[model samples]
Target: MQSNKTQQGGVLGVFPHYHWRATEQEVDMAMPAPAPRPLRLNAEPQNLVIDLRRTAIVVIDMQNDFCAPGGWVDHIGGNFAADRAAIEPLQALLPALREAQVPVVWVNWGNRPDLANMPPNQIHLYKNSGSGTGLGDPLPDGRGNVLEKGSWAAAIVDELAPLPGDILVDKHRISGFWDTPLDSILRNLGVKTILFAGCNTDQCVLHSLTDANFLGYGCVMLEDCCATSSPDFCTQATIWNVKKCFGFVTDSTTLLAALQAPPA
Candidate 1:
């Protein structure tokens, strides 16, 4: 008997099962899976062991319109300063995650210029009185159109600008998964566990995490990495609902320590 080894061409997709390598004569679909980078972290409800190879950090609505002064939240008289709490922790956490090769996904409210895709209800969420600066409307400060795509209002905050390889998903609704390519992008990247962090913890972050849970992704809410201008009770309820219903809750401190700890 003679032994034959298959030699194939370039690899295809991110994950092993979805990837294929083809030569002029043959195609090899048996690419080996990447080594798992597992990190055990202390979390509420229970501890979690996540594979960095299959995990992504989803930072939701950490945009200028929500977090910075002279932006939408500030214009609407919301305490934008409160939302800034997540900024420092995320500043320290994201770079570390990127260093560990974990994907960073930013899901922010970047609306269509004409607001054509936005439903009346969605627009009403921001502009309840039906008259005032809302989605796509020019800000009184002349900074840019409110949350319009390609505007400063829609950009991530200066302190946390996304790196070249980071993924950005424009979301019109509270749930980033709705009517967006977010789920598809995660699926293509072979992401099974999502570490959620961003502003308005009781609203956008919580809703997005819930949607990810519904779609069967493992969700972990990084407590200190999420902030909201809402009242303190709101944060408590959001965290409770997350641990009781949607997913586990953890903080950046625990995660960062786990990431930096010597590999076992």
Candidate 2:
């Protein structure tokens, strides 16, 4: 290794070469963070396009058991507010969507009386999860029973109650399509695009959305209208994955505006 450190008087060693210092020039190249994706805005990443006219709203697991106080959510030590947060946005979005003639489908947890078709793993998980409640368990207030078909606790919230023409599909698993007629109903209705909103964004909402995407349905997640009892990171990660892979992500405000916006 040779040393070239003996430069003297702004000159290179043994040569009259001058030492040159280059000045750094400022650049106007500050890249700003991208604007967040808007609600109900049609974004076609990976060739997925959302058609509002063909879209149906699927509200997942926003039943009394999950959102109402003294229901399974509160019984499981979950913050009621976390599950209840979606109510207002859903209430606001539903009327507009209904007026637009979009079909409203409620996918809820409604198990059979015999629990004959219930999976053992799910039963064990919920029964031993320290909530002391399981399928067919009586709710605290006795207004309805948990997971029992046609029970009040298994019903949708009053604020966003289904109208006369709305469809109701009972689901046994986290994913609405698992052992349910949700897919058949949507397909029969000629629905190709689905907008999802409801409780437990990371669990039921994520599962159902993934299933819908897998079934080749264009999915749009109503971000503000989907919530979870888990930490915020869980919901954020769900939204990220949805936008990155599953489908589009938007909020209620943006969705409402998009729904009300005149066609181009």
Candidate 3:
């Protein structure tokens, strides 16, 4: 499938396709898992079976700039309505996932003031730091680890800070898998499937989803939980293209249904 999306007011474009697959030669490694999580559900004939013990929820960049009013976006000034719409849904989803005892990985972005300390820009030209901050911040629970992407600006947004016990996987590019231990962490946790939800659907979210598909991890995108600079077109394209290529499309309610089932 081919798609054309203009996000962040056409500043960011999203192109998603489904024709990619992981090769057999590349998936022979089994990464160790985090300690076994309590398994409370089984696969029903109609419902999906998830060994919660082997699943992970990756919450991407739900930061202050994107979610909170007048935080960081005031500077860049893209789409507040669009970003707000995205943050509201995940706010609800996180609690449900936590109740079900599923692992939630917070993907944060941040770097130093000097551009020289970062990976060379993927878009060709180097970009300057924006107030030295990422849009989000670590949730206060101490469970969330703050993964800084480009500069200090990359921490989890202050509005939806990660909780304690949360794992922080830092990166330098749009795709979280780039130069990050995220892949190994998921493998080690026996996480065969990934539940993806977060900010900027057009950028990091989209890239990560495609990469995840290439990595062969089952992806279930929580639709309402993620948003972009454009509330309508970009958001819609993200949901559509991601469903078409990277993984399945779903909402928080559907996810809860699958997770609440009795043991298999």
| Number of the predicted model whose TM-score against the real structure is largest | 1
Q: What digit string (tens of lDDT, one per residue) describes model 1 on residues 180-241?
A: 99999888777899999998899999999999999999999999999999899999999999
lDDT of 3 by residue, 21-109 (tens): 22544532332323544443322122344556567888777765455544455444556556666566666777777776566898756
Give the Å error, residue 109, model 2: 0.3
TM-score of every prediction relative to native: 0.93, 0.80, 0.68
RMSD to true structure for each model, in Å: 5.0, 22.5, 13.5
Model 1 quality (TM-score): 0.93
lDDT of 2 by residue, 89-167 (tens): 9889989987876779999998887888987887886787645878877777676667688888888878778888788
lDDT-based ranking: 1, 2, 3
Q: Is candidate 2 or candidate 3 better by lDDT?
A: 2
What is the alpha-carbon lDDT of model 1 when measured against the actual structure? 0.89
> Could you tell me which 10 consecutive residues in candidate 3 have the lowest summed lDDT?
11-20
Better of 1 and 2 by TM-score: 1
Every candidate's lDDT: 0.89, 0.77, 0.61
Better of 1 and 2 by lDDT: 1
